[model samples]
Target: MSLPMTCRRSSPRLLSLCLAIAGALAAQSAIAADSSAATETSDDAAHPPASDTRHAEHAEKSKRAVDLDTVVVTASPLRTTAGDLGKPAAVLAGERLDEDRASSLGETVSSIPGVQSSNFGPGVGRPIIRGLDGPRVSVLSDGLSTEDVSTVSQDHSPAIEPFLADQIEVLKGPSTLLYGSGAIGGVVNVVDGRIPEEAIENGFGGRAEARFFGGDQDGTTDMARIDGGTDRFALHADAVYRNAKDYDTPDGVQANSFIDTKSGAVGGSLLGDWGFVGLSASRFEDGYGNPGEPGDLSAGERGVHLQLRQNRYDLKGGLKDLWGEGNGLRFSFGHTDYDHIEFEGDEPGTTFTKNANEGRVEATFGNRDAWQGAVGVQGTDSTFAAVGEESFVPQTTTRGYGAFGIARRSWGDFQLDFGARVDKVKSEPDAMASRDFTPLSLSLSGGWKLGENWRLTANLDHAERAPVEEELFANGPHIATLAYEVGDPNLDKEAANQLELGLQYKSSLVDAKVSAYYNRFKDFIYLVDTGDQWYWDEENDYLPIRQWSQSNAIFRGFEGEATFHLADNDSGRWDLRAFGDTVRATLADGGGNVPRIPPSRLGAQLRWENGDWRASLGATRVNRQDKVATNETPTAGYTMIDAHAARHFDTGNVGWELFVDGTNLTNQVGRVHTSFLKDDVELPGRSFDVGVRVFF
Candidate 1:
């Protein structure tokens, strides 16, 4: 008799080795409990209280400087500051987010440490954290899943609007207990006010921004947001539209690289001292082309266009001090309908649709004795289908339920946190056998404040994930990836054991943080090329044959960042910053190195701020990636320089900013190894954008 693929056990040697390193580090310095690299949420600073007219008037009199410590809601069910969490976390908002905004969420935050973008093109991209992408990483809107088919392929985009977001949070390591199975890699949560949590002040406020970008290609973008309310009622609305033409490469024009996207949302809420209730409706539409290789055209297939659409309805409510002496309740529900069509010239090729609904309720208990945390239950149901040619996976329906809790306690100069979750999942394929799985996840972490200037933090987590529908039923060609895929129905669950250690230093002159992590997996599910090719029709067009398989794997990485305040005087402030990140992944069973791993990168920046003007000059260098799998090739790296300058003006009721941004200033031809289209498309060269934004 043979054993199953999944098993539960501990690696004593690896555990002991990591524990020794952590112990040594703990002896030298106490680690900070929170990361110091995040910026504060700008909404509280941008909008004043409506009840205090005096404060509102004073706020308009003098603008406040942005804060570096911002509150984040994704770390736990209860909102906590980014610096209070035990993981390496980052926040993007206000001026920083706007300056880095792009057509895809992945590119918008690619500069963050330990994060990389899997750019399919300007039309589709997704985040890769550490050395993990695809099904391991989870992308969320606010706190719920986007419920899109993006995870099925690299060419599909997440059905969410990034331009309307007020803030974006990135968690760099295992955050499984809070979000659930797929978050073993990390979480990217996009926060917006589509459903108003609080009433807007001053009765009315809004902003409108427009931008024009040109390089080898040209693009235009327009966005608008508005919020207004009485003391107890609020209304919010936002919209964004973008259009771009085919981009140019060092060789010539990359064919069929155009994009068109539009999104809008409307929301209303009732607010009071006891909390608030709100509801919202949103719609998103995207039409884009897939830029294939110049000579990779098939009979009757001149061009490929994808038409994607989504409609979502959300309801949220909360009650403070309701259940117990110091308890509160918060509940949220969302329903999403999504569909996409692949069009080959004037003919329809394939149509995909997904319908999903999710609901969650949580209760937070205040500090009693020494423990404080929240408990919650979440339920989700989804149906996915594909019709016409290239329908790889059969129609499938998934139902899931989970219960989770997290608690924290403080003792002397040390803080300890613990969390646990259990989930039940069922996947039913119309033409295949039904599969059921139960996964359990847990986490433990501690932070020791080593005096006033330094701190040390350590965390351990165990996460388990069940196979998704595509991994269990796919049995056809996926032209988007240029591969024929086969799935294994008897595949078992995946489990990961990870450990992380971090150190932080904060003072008047310098702010620095460094972290290292190791993860070991059991029954890791991955797609492996079978070294066989399948021909498409009678044309002899062929693709590699790949099969979903299970193996043991390990990934390890380190990342660090530091900022030094060079000068702070009445004239202005000057700062110097440096950051670097790298990761190595391999199969423990000696299969080979993992494919498409991002190359190591190092960057430095010199920045200056004086009154209404801000300027920065920076350079980044990516090292060549020589680590290759059996079926993959090596990729060369390159260096890039970028610059930006902006000026702010106050015009009575409106404040506006004029900015000019330059990328690839040196005009270096670079290829991103993480991109599926790296061989067919070249990264944009020497681009410049001049834009203006007005807020009133």
Candidate 2:
């Protein structure tokens, strides 16, 4: 029998490796900006564009200087704010993303306060917010959920295309009321307008972008996209190819990032003054799998190859301004084709297929109001199958439907919200007992303003989750996690309720936010090891030779974030800033700590910028933790530090930026307290990635 081992994932090897490459890449892309009035100055050279003299003579006589203001509007709030939503949120420009050379969405966002990541391999990782993941957090695009298995399992990858999005939104609260139920943790929304500006006038506009990751995987992302619109109709399309080699760990630990992913998407819309009609189709295909770390082989030495192809189409429309004005309406129907199969050899041979379709309709009563409300309904149908000469599980089908409502109000100095939902899920498979689940969820919140810069916010949330068919009925080796997971068809739904309180403070130069929460669970759904590995067969396949049940659990935590504007010069030349976060969570009973929960951590940065030139230095400390859950791995404490610089250039109306990012500067090798297998599977040490961005 092959024994399982945990691979410590917090090592700073790959993190520091990237730092060594930054200087070389920076020198390779050295290009300076001009300072001729309209010209932008680079860090290497500075002379303030000569004050745009075109208006200088008259402007100087009047002694009037140019001033700029920023407005930030997000789905989380009822209205737009002055870059401060009063809740804990972070806004990162796509340009700043370039300077980081981040390969995965989690890696990019991990730089933010109170965020971490779950790494399956070099090619795949998911964001961990406040020590919570999976269905606890919802990831969406254009207000619609991405129908991928990432929400179901850690090994599965998300299907949405990140490179195509215009901006990313991170909502760290139960504000997911509108998106769906079971979002008691938080929400992540990736925004892609999918509209063409030129199409409105000339009927067309297109963009192309490419970035390369030259670390251990030697990976590359090449993409091209185009969109156009007419008086009443418009179209948008995108195509991308991503490929990478096996990655190398710190101390040259051998690993694999060898994966190939190809995806394409097309969408269209009909426009009008009151509302717009839209449609879109997308497909994602990839061949990838996770490998064992050294002796870690619960699933075995050779992992299953992946042949996954997912396709989806959506028909949607929203009233830009309707319901007599100041109101909006959204109607949508969506269909999906999901297929995933595990291969026989070094490459995929056999497979499994799942097909699904969903539809939803919702309406918003007001965009900005002291009182606002909305209601929506959604439904889904999904079927599953297995492939090859040796068939395993029989055909299975699952269906679900739900109705949801949300309302908000602000009176005096208090802002309050209430939301509720009811859902039903049913599933059937060959030779297995049928099952049905009815889940109810609700959330309520209230906030008070202590003063112009101080606020107190509180919320209570109740949610439930039904176990998936596979988790409830599986009888053989799934190969994803290398475990022969057995399912209990008689399992019960997991129900939870949580109470939270928060404090926020905003000032011209200082910002601070803190939150405390306590969550209780009834029949909480969790995975347990049978301690026996078996190769289950048909006649003996009621389960993977193991049994499962439910348990009661509780989770509580506190998180804090702070941001300081160290300095900002009136010359529009220089601005400096620093920020960081800390978090801690306590679990219930002898069930031990929650699995894959992030530990207490802190990060700080020093950034300076004047005009087109920018520079930064940062440090992060993740405390060492030995307190772990059953089957969970332990990681040592570690600290990391780094620095970088970049410059922007402009010619005519087009502009470009070249930058190099350094990571894991201090070369710390620390492990995480949140991983199930953190001991054997380690995080990549120091590494480097270089890239460029252009605006037209």
Candidate 3:
């Protein structure tokens, strides 16, 4: 099973995540917590009960994860549990979702150290983690690859339905070494408990939530979601529709980032103690645009206009003691169909279809205090189709197969994690030549425990990727901004060899972590303009005329984070925590800075809770990055501030609660500094929402 984190735009200003999980785009904004917890599992045994689903929604009210503290198990094929993660991570839950209604999942996620957002518009956004985006990141549904358009390019959207996940997981740094080589940056997993584990006895549980917002702009959401269980069966289903008018800039300029978004979803499943099974499907449609671009005011090509649709089904089974005790295996297979079209200027509309099917399986060896390791296989079969476009792969087929291994062991006073992965990628374009390549990667980590309150961890990773449809066959006008980009048929996959060193401290009141890294790239595939008719051709493809080649480059960075928990064990006051995370990046002396890479980033937050009420204040700083590389572009810096509070009403159910939310108390101006188009493209102005949640 491969659990993926899908990011989407929230509020009128929801998140724009780079990767579908978080759909990691740029537009995503902050959303309060609506997360759940998990339990550990033995090597060969199935888990007793899984955590609740973490839905992606924005409510006016807010709360902290501690209030609903829970671990997320079965994130991947490996039998790794929350406790095994050891590294720093955060989980969001219900009330927290209510409080941060102004933005989307990507925005809320950016609050984490080393995480950033890539916005497309209010309806589309995805998260970019630790400088990783595109094919390097994986977005899965319940541990199965989403295989949707979201991973194809920045202009595309993911197929995940955020308003329904049971919980969200953010894993930063080398800790994700076990996931995949591309995860050298990090991992964000969205957990949906739609599949039941324990048989229902008789009763069923469900919740309904609806939200609306009107301000400097207009916003409305019609969402109805519910999850309940019977004596031996549990099920879940929900639907949501959203839309927003153009928002005004601080200068009162009508930023064309207006949004016309709509969505509908339906899903259900059967539960069991040994494991559960289920199916889900959704549809998303929208028209959106960007403002503040240079050049002449183009024609009808304003923003992204699409009639996007998708469908998916997953059958997963959990088994223990395949042959004996303390031994188990998890298997899942999924298929998805996604289609969308983009309209740019006089350029004809460019449409594409992404049909993908994937399978994954993992086996783990179990024994307490004994050495442990897991081996798994992942395969993806996909087709990329384009309408009226001709190039490297206007219509092509690609496949990927990978095998990975991770091991853990204890040595007297220290622990070590050593792992490696090998991916074999093969592609065949219609009427074109066939291609094949295999990438090799590895990860190594060491931990030394000094009296339990202090520790040290160091990691190293070497990962690579093959070119995607856009990098090899992208040729068309950007419907949103009216710019054309022709693809370079002979581009090669980019590779990164990186290193990281860090220190960590955790006492009765505070936790802190700091790390520094360096990465070298070879045959890097980045988009460049051909500079004619404002009509663009991928520059690096062939220098002056007919040919085939690519550009090479390097990038490096440093990141750190810390937190202080003010509430003590003796205090029934609950949570009183202060935290912050930061990242800074630079290009090699001769290399141009990567386009749209944000400069130094800083964030701070304060949270308090007493019984049923909780409040929080957050502030973020993104420095301007005018340091342009020989061929890379530069972006400006900006600051964002937000605050929220919420009160919970327990329903007496084992895991059931309700709350109201308020957001953007100041309705601060929004900007995505790292965006390629950030001039007049400000984030949503401000917003608010109310919601309810239940779990049994």
Candidate 4:
């Protein structure tokens, strides 16, 4: 089958992707033969000597196992596992990731403790970590900045497609030691495996999936990915498409809450004994409505909608044994062209554009048993512009350079880790004097094994973040936020001193973890309600006046999760899990509570797994939030119920999986306190998602 003529005419890139898919399908037969032969050869080579048969069996089992603690975190330059890391981290992949996947990146990972989503609507959801959002948190794609303008506004969605990700990693605390000033709060990295780091064991492999969402949301999503290559060279391609109509809320249908997205990428790599070199090109297009400003037809007002497009190119390479047997060097570069248009009715109201280039190089040395460390340098150059009626911020250019080093040492049952980073950042506006900031960050962490089943960890972090473009120069009205925003050009960099303590216990019957953290900020930047209003003659209304302000503040939080292995017998393997998180933020001088902080939440899940079938049922309770900043109203509490089930089987030489996911089963009227449009927009109503996946 081929794409329609209209699809072919829509964009050359789309046409090329369609052709690539067709080509991949046509070569499946030959690829299958090669895969079969490769598998046979591998099986024959797996035979071990009788003397080492038991050890070889154990090694084989480990190779085929997928353990969250054992998964290597690609975000870390040292390539360490989550269990070995000095700080708290979470990895979502395999069946778990598939069950948790959502349309937005924020929702996809919100289940993790200490993390939540900032929802403008169904179309826009950004990750918020430990009461921090916007510029504080860094969103990354394959360890590099996504280079999107999401931080500039609450209504903008990230340019990444979560459905295509192979694994998503969340670093829960201050990660500025590795990711720079933007990660003063933390980091979220989506690994898509677009650029293969190693050869495909099966010679050729791919997966395709199609899903439909029913109930409050009527949507369809389709995606496909293929990887093929020899020991010397490899290729990859992936594509995704999604469309959804206005979703229904408890009050009624969300008038302007629709979404449409299309994205695709192609990558290739050259592999050898030394290392690998790879390059990839990707395109993303999205169109979504702003429910906050739903227009009235009687008043001749048109609903607001946004159209976004981005093209990105990435190049990555690595060299092994550079200095010694255990030493390696890696480098990556990315260039992105991004633009978005906000439409008022049928006319374009505002246009935003960004062009950016970023690069990073790092070298790793030593071994994990004794001492290991990594040193890296990173640089970024970006230009941003806004024009048209709703333009609130002026054109600006930002340049940043940083160098960082991290080292870890272990002795017996004790481990210590330390890191430091220094950065120089400059922001130059079109007609204003440029601002420069020099920020330094340092961190120290230690972990000790208490016994065979218990462990303890502690961390101290001093991180600094430079003000972003919006925080330092934004001015005028932002319709999406319904506010007249003002900025202070003389704003200084923000600094944070944080401490964290954690404990863990693991056994055959139960696994658990708990952590507590506190942060003190010397200069915290936040949007303040000035008790003033701006009267717009065109809209004949007064908009709230908000100004960017700085003050000393403190944040404290606790997060924990535990799982109990209930039963593992003929019926199936049953596991019960419980998780909860709470955070409090307020001014150090008792000025007021921080606005838009996520409410406390407690959740539990019952999961069952068998040979080829799995299922889960869960519920979360969100507590009411009354601790609000001046002029901010309180939000009520809510309870959400969700469930999932899947069946796996094989057909001939191919594998197939059928899955169903139900969210908000009770159709709760939940309001996200962290959202700018919380009062105007309720969470989507009950929805059941049914899907089928095919593997080759």
Q: Tens digits of per-residue lDDT for model 1 on 593-623?
A: 8788999999998888877778889999988
After superposing candidate 2 on the true structure, give the runs of residues whose Cα lies further than 4 Å from its correct spot: 1-93, 96-101, 173-176, 181-184, 195-207, 215-217, 230-233, 293-304, 347-350, 366-370, 386-395, 533-548, 570-587, 642-644, 666-677
Q: Quick one: best lDDT, which candidate?
A: 4
Q: Give the number of colliding residue pairs in candidate 1.
A: 8
**Each candidate: how many clashes?**
8, 43, 106, 0
Q: What is the lDDT of candidate 2?
A: 0.58
Deviation of model 2 at 352, angstroms: 3.4
Candidate 1 RMSD to the correct structure = 13.9
Query: Candidate 3 lDDT, tens digit per residue, 1-696?
Result: 111121133432222111221221111111102212222233223322332233211211232353322344456344444433445455554555445433344655665556777776555566677666656666556677666776555545566555555556666653334455445455666665555554322233334344445555565554444444443455555555566666655556454555555655555555444544556555556455434321234653444345566666666666656644555666777777777765443343667788888888877774547776777888888887877442223677888888888787877768787787887777777766767767777777677777777777666666767676665665555434334556676666667776666666777676666666666666766554444454245533322111123555555566666667766443433333334343444444444455566567776777666555666776666776676544445566556666665555432332223343443445556567555455556665554454333332
lDDT of 2 by residue, 1-696 (tens): 111111122124322323322332232233112111211212100111111211221122222212111223334424334233434455443444444424456666776666777666644566677666776677666556666666545656666666665556666655434554435456666555553211232343333444455453366665555544454666787776777666555656545345788888888777655456777888888766554423223555554456678888878766644564556666667677777765544545545566777777776675344667777787778777766632334567878888888777778788777888888888888888888888788888777999999888887888777766656776665444556666778888877787878887788777777777777878765666666767445435432333455778776667666667666675333334344454444345566665556766677767666666677777777776666666556677777777777666554332344656666654455444554335545555665555454332
lDDT of 4 by residue, 1-696 (tens): 454343465345445544665566558766766554432211110111111211121222111114577667889887777787889999887667888888899999999999999898887888999999888999999989999999999999999999998778999888999989999999999988787776665577677777778999998788988887877777898989989999998788988898999999999998777777899999999999999988875788879999999999999887877777667898999999999999998889899999999999999888867788999999999999999977788999999999999999999999999999999999999888899999999999999999899889999999999999988899999988899999999999999999999999999999899999999998899999999999999989999999999999999999999999999888988999999999999987878998899999999999988777789999999999999999999999999999999877664444567889999999999999988888889998898998777565
Considering every candidate listed, which one attains the maximal TM-score?
A: 4
Which ten-residue region of model 3 has the weakest summed lDDT?
23-32
lDDT pick, better of 3 and 4: 4
Better of 1 and 4 by TM-score: 4
Query: Which candidate do you rate higher for TM-score, 3 or 4?
Result: 4
Between candidates 2 and 4, which one is better according to TM-score?
4
The Cα error of candidate 1 at residue 415, in Å, is 0.8
